[model samples]
Target chain A: MTDRSQLPAIRQQVTELVLAGSPEHAEEAINETAEKFGDLAVVEVLGELEPQVASLHLSSFDGGKMSLATLLIPPKAWAESLAYFAATWDEDWIEDEPEVLAESLFAHIHGMVFGTDDEERRAELLNAALATDWGTTAFAVLFSTAAEEIIEIANDIHNLGAHRSGSTTSDHDVIPMALEIARTNEEGWDRILFEIFPDWRPGENELHAASEEESDDDLGDEEARESEFAMGRSTKELLLRLRKQVPSKAVAPAKKGARPSLGEDIFS
Target chain B: MNITSYTARTPQLVQALEALGQRADEQAAGILFDELCGITALVAKKFTNDRTAEGIHEAFHLTVGCISLAISQADIADTGEAKLSFLLQHGAEYVFQMGFRHIKELSALPYTAFVSDFDNDPFVQQRNLKAIFMEICSADPATTWSGDAVYQNEIVDRKRNQHIIDCGKWLRKHNAAGVVRDSEMDANAAITVAVLFALSGDGRIVARTAQRPLENLIAHIRDTKPDVDASWDKFLKKIPPEFQPLLRERMEQLRGTIVKKLYGKTKPKTLLTELQDHYIGSEQDIDYA
Candidate 1:
């Protein structure tokens, strides 16, 4: 892991560039600079104090809007790019190198947007993603965290003809492809949600609960039936039937504070 | 895990025994069972002292009560044929600790239609019914909380007193006609309107308590002025006896205040102040005495 002390440099560079400048002016600089970097093909910057980590497009080119984001962080937390896939998905990531995969994704998005791989800014982006206050700021922090691979793809597509050895993917096409992959991964999570939250799931049981009047009536009827059968059938059968009927999965809830008394014959 | 194991065993035996008996209605029986299961879950959360046995027991009992109430409401001879308006009103009264006035308002066509057809309209339909009720209450202060805490409590106390007076009046009115048909609506409406009157803090208490004397006065007025409207006379007579005198005195004081302001002894609170002032004396002299 990189030492934590290095984060200040990354934060300072971002504050100086993006924060110090107006959003409109910074946006213009970003668009002009991203094209310049893509044309040059070699990502290099000259400076002792002001290191150019990446070029970002802050305006429209080819009808797509450009926005700029920067990141500064310690090298220790810089090894891997982590993407938060919250709304249920499958574990489709097949690669063994998690950190390398993350880094690659980060480099891809940054390269696509800026046309240069700026490590200082990349590091800062990673730090922001891992920070607790991520939600309060612009949504780009989240996009940046996920942008690693997508950025690389965009950059490769933008500079497609430069490397003659292999063909490059186009920038416009890369985003839709990445979105398709993301959606594919999200299907499993959707299934899990349906399995958990019945109200969100489709069915008569879910619909009945949504109603104001009949829900109480339905609940009443269900309870009476369960109690009537509680003595005549096995508890396992009763529970199984209930679980099958209702969408909510049943786990024997944890008994709190003290053990329950089994002697009372309230049902009898 | 131990408790789960124990519960798993006992409820099974209990279930087995329960299944052997014949139920009043198997469909209703199933619904009741489901409700009990829900209540059991609720009880488990609440009375956790004996989490295992007590939770299950409490839930089972509550479930039984819930099912019984549901069945009773449903089994009554009149079901769907009962007017939706009355059902909605009664349902609100039973479920919500709402005052009668609110019950009337929510059940009114405009509000009920807005809630039920909210989705097609989008602007108002998506809102929850209870939230809409609270919003309506918040907009009208007198319809909700009384102006002050003391007044609210007094209103509640006077309301009960007013109900007693109403029942007495109804009985007297019924006796005069030699009719003895029970009227739930009349009794309910009396208490409900009295609640509003008390809440208004209009010192309608004396008038409300003076129902008997007022009724007698109205009966006399109708007998003498056979051509006069009986219902209008009844309404006027229902106004408390003390309120008439208090209102007259207030009108006189208002006239004096207005005259003083008109003469420039006191500046009017507004430009057209005389128009706003009470001409109650003239109105009352012609009507009441």
Candidate 2:
């Protein structure tokens, strides 16, 4: 939707503002430009102007000062920028490792906006991240570091019945995706899940109840129903096995709506 | 290949020296110093102290050389001079400290050579003269020591004595007007005095001349109403341990006077409590030697 010809002028304006000792103005200009242009185009400009922007930011010597253009820009913009970089990463264009760059950007976003009261922005950012393959490694790290934020976003998405177009991703897709990614690093599965569900446990009755609840809802078609059933069965099996595998001492205290305790002493 | 192996690692040493000289700030200097420390540790482990002395001497020489160069090229209007001076002073101190820590008997040749080089360099001498004049001129009038009476009879440099007189006159004029400016220049002036005193042959005599200034500075600080964020603690920390007793004694005397000034007639217990609240005593030791 953005006019391609305006980018160079915007960049020049930003540079002039920074040079004129109006960093706040420069930040405003950058954010405005990012909003006007799509994320990919703005990110390309940012990548080219990274050194100049970094120098300008570092000259002031206040870490908390949001002078970094990336920080001032929207979360969705950064997510999309990251996605673009991941898609088009080449060794000749970018000397630094793409994964490292993506991780650092994601970490910065997570630090600034993850647990804040910006639920809509957080969901959009998470969705943008999930939309890219470059985010898999970053997500694994994020899953551990920001389990609550990720889980909260997943729950919100589920409640709203939001799914990516042309994909069968449902409200419960996040758990399976997380499990698949987490299995690559098997050592973190117990800790990650414990932090995610906290007091979750698997029992036959609970599994049955979850299946019945799914069935009662509109599943759309026979194929959809069969697929949902298969996914639910696998998820329940994974959770049950994971619940069993987790050391009893590591289990969190039960929350109000958490499942009741089973009689078996897993720790023993 | 045999000849190459036999050759001294002078290029590597030069490269390291250049890298060190290029450090423009305290943080950079600290990083370079840490690297030097690591290199020195490794060298010490691998070779004899005699062999390691070459590298150590080269480092010291390069540090002094860089400082001399910076001094020669300093522009006071810009902050470059202040940054360079900070790097030089702290960098030199770090080098000496590390050398003393690692090498038991650090050869004095490199230090002597640096001093000789610094003294003979006309640019450096001129800079030092200008610095001494500036330090004296900007010094707190109330705390400015009148060295004319003490050094008049002694056979000292005429220019130095004249500068001292000029400083005394300026201090009298400013102190009468109650004009005081707190700046980094003040910290630099103090450092200049300390460095000059250390480099002088008759350091004890210099210390004696500074006694009045030290006392006046302490009294002036005490007379000022204390605040929670007062820089008095930081000033105390800056003074070397050898000079601390003199300042401490002066501070205690000033405290008594201030207490009397505050309360015309107070009990000993009340005075003690008031003093305790006003002045926080510190236990940390400062070593500048």
Candidate 3:
């Protein structure tokens, strides 16, 4: 665990070095800046970056581990720089969704140009930026937009509670409950999405297999067995029906007995 | 007195009518009269594009106002015939709009569509309403967009009991970060807020004044000087010990040049400039690997 007090010094060094020029010159400026300002911005930004590595905390009892990741964006006045470069570099593509790509590009430049002090953070941020189609803006937009919409919904529901109440109803009771639902649905969506599909897009096959595995892990309870069967039956029915309707190029074998039979497997 | 006659006479009663429609106990005639008046007021606002007290008395019926009238009749036994006739004529056209869909669905319910008071089964109505919103929003991507696309995607992504819990976790992280205050958020509240936020594409949650200084500092990292790992560490320390490593690990894995690209700015005076610079983009070179 790192000490939080060191942040101020690191922040100062990073600030001075950012003002100074070039990676080569940065070392000297950072040192001087650190001595003068003590752990300023430059060092804070550049210091602890580790390459493509993260810590995973494991349960002492189960030895189960979970990966902890990082994303580091360096501070620089590169917004205009990135926008201009993107605009001219790919004029044809710029019109497609400039906001999306600009966000991605700027995010990339920020990380690479300013660089990370933490090696692990540096690697993670850079990697994530490169790996994901959209960059920080997408994330920021998603987060902020979601928050705003939720608040609006909550306010609307609250207003409805107050505005729509009858002789028997009290405003206090209805508003808070409606507000709570609006809030829950808003926040739960992202967490659920990320948890289920960390990759952003988990295909149906992968999704099914994951669910099956999850079900299998639980030794057969009657309810679990029945639910799994029901799910499997419904999924099969959906796939078969879809295949028939779409005239699939590929054939899927219908499962015997337990699975719904689509006569003359279309994919075949 | 016939409710429709009253509604026809008093045009400004739609809001009151809608409010009356919410309650089971309201004298059906009185409620109907008030709702018609509210609908008239609404129509007046629509045609005039603003409200005038006298315009509220204009008895002219818009398509939606008619449907609302019909749907209101769906509730009462005595007025069902005349209202049904009006609805049958225009309900198809009116139903195309979202507000009428809400009216139609609520009218179909055994309980009044709009509830005057909070009930123990508030979740039932809330969920039903939310589902209706989702349907309306998702009807056509071009015509109607989900305010909570990301959230909907999550639900559609997987079928799991744990999804609810997982959503709570995501909401908590987002709620605590930058300009978002602890007072403004809790797990349940965060989840609801996230859903609404996702749908509308508006990010404002808590007031800027309500946020803590450390929260502001974190915002600086995310928007202006993004050191995801560092910020993660800084944030994690402030959070409960159990959550620190979890958040830290997530941030660590999310790092890279792209992550760097997103947030590495050095503004001397304030973090806002750096955030804006990134938001707008800079005239820099692209480094693709």
Q: Which lDDT values do the candidates have, in the order given? A: 0.31, 0.37, 0.33
What are the per-residue Cα lDDT tens digits for candidate 1 across B21-134? 333445434433443354456534533223677546544443333222222223233232232222222331221122322322332223210112233454343343334332
Residue lDDT tens for model 1, A73-189: 122222111111111111233123333333333343443323426644443433333242211111122232333343343234334422321232434333442332223333322
lDDT of 2 by residue, B1-289 (tens): 5644322222222333444566544555555455344434433332224256765544333333222223222332323345444434444334323322222211111221111335446676545443332222121212222221112222134333333333322322333224323211221122222322222222221111133343333344345534312333444454556545544454455544643343244544454344334431110012211
Q: For each candidate, report its DockQ versus the true two-chain complex.
A: 0.01, 0.00, 0.00
Using DockQ as the measure, which candidate wins?
Answer: 1
Tens digits of per-residue lDDT for model 3, A59-119: 0101121111112223221211221222222433443453454344334443342333564
Q: Name the DockQ score for candidate 1.
A: 0.01
Give per-residue CA lDDT, model 2, range A1-268, as digits (tens): 5677877777777677776888788777766776777566565555445443433532332334544454334444444444232222344322444334334434444543433345565555455544444333335333433344344433444344334212323344234444333333333333433333434342211111123255566647634544332212222232223223222233555433322321221101
The DockQ assigned to candidate 3 is 0.00
Better of 2 and 3 by lDDT: 2
What TM-score would you report for chain A in candidate 3?
0.21
lDDT of 2 at B244: 51
Candidate 1 ranges with C-alpha deviation above 4 Å? A1-114, A117-268, B1-147, B150-184, B188-289
Per-prediction TM-score to the true structure, in the order listed: 0.21, 0.22, 0.18
